[model samples]
Target: MSDLIELRDRMRAFTEERDWAQFHDPKSLILALVGEVGELAELFQWLPADSAAARVQDEPLRSRVGEEMADVLLYLVRLADVLEIDLGDAAMRKLSGSASRFPPDDVRGQAPEKA
Candidate 1:
């Protein structure tokens, strides 16, 4: 199985073990995801674009950033699991749609048209 699938399964088991499925409805998961994203964003909130990249070189900040990123990913995977969504397939389908909407040759070096 793919790593993401394995990770999703692991997340499912973890949630089941905690009996937390009751708290994992789509709306709650989405809110939790937003919170995680906010935490991740906070890490780079005031940094200049260049400095934001450099900030990851600092071990403590890097660790926090990594944790926040993991939280975001875990919540996303769990949400997908709870919703019975195949994230990999969904991502590919989205990518295909995006490719059709914004063909590389047509959109290269240009901003995408507002949908």
Candidate 2:
């Protein structure tokens, strides 16, 4: 697997090949990320909570979820790359911020929460 730096470059080149940089400004990237997440959620439309919970067990459903997840993360990582942000540093800072909001000791075996 490639490191984030290599992956960022790879993604950049891939986008550049299609002249997509103009469409990937920060605001648009953020919107695209949200839209992809909405698409992911749409997969569970009209399903009961229990059925939604079971969706991950279905391989095809998992693939759809994975696709959306990858889209979200791709935009995020690319946004950071474009903004000259260090992925590791940014992540550590975010995790450090979370430390105050959610103590590691307190979070063990508990459900994750939105930050």
Shift in Å, residue 74, candidate 2: 1.0
Q: How big is the positional error of residue 1 in model 1, measured in Å on the Cα after superposition? A: 0.6
Candidate 1's displacement at residue 100, Å, is 1.7
Q: Looking at model 1, how many pairs of residues clash?
A: 0
Any idea what lDDT model 1 has? 0.92
Per-residue C-alpha lDDT of model 2 across residues 41-110, encoded as one tens digit per residue: 7887777897787867788888988888888788878888778889877798998998888887989778
Looking at model 1, which ten-residue stretch has the lowest summed lDDT? 106-115
Per-residue lDDT value at 77 in model 2: 83
Q: What's the TM-score of each model vs. the native?
A: 0.91, 0.76
lDDT of 1 by residue, 14-105 (tens): 98999999999999999999999999999898888978888798999989999999999999998999899999999999989898999888
lDDT of 1 at 104: 80
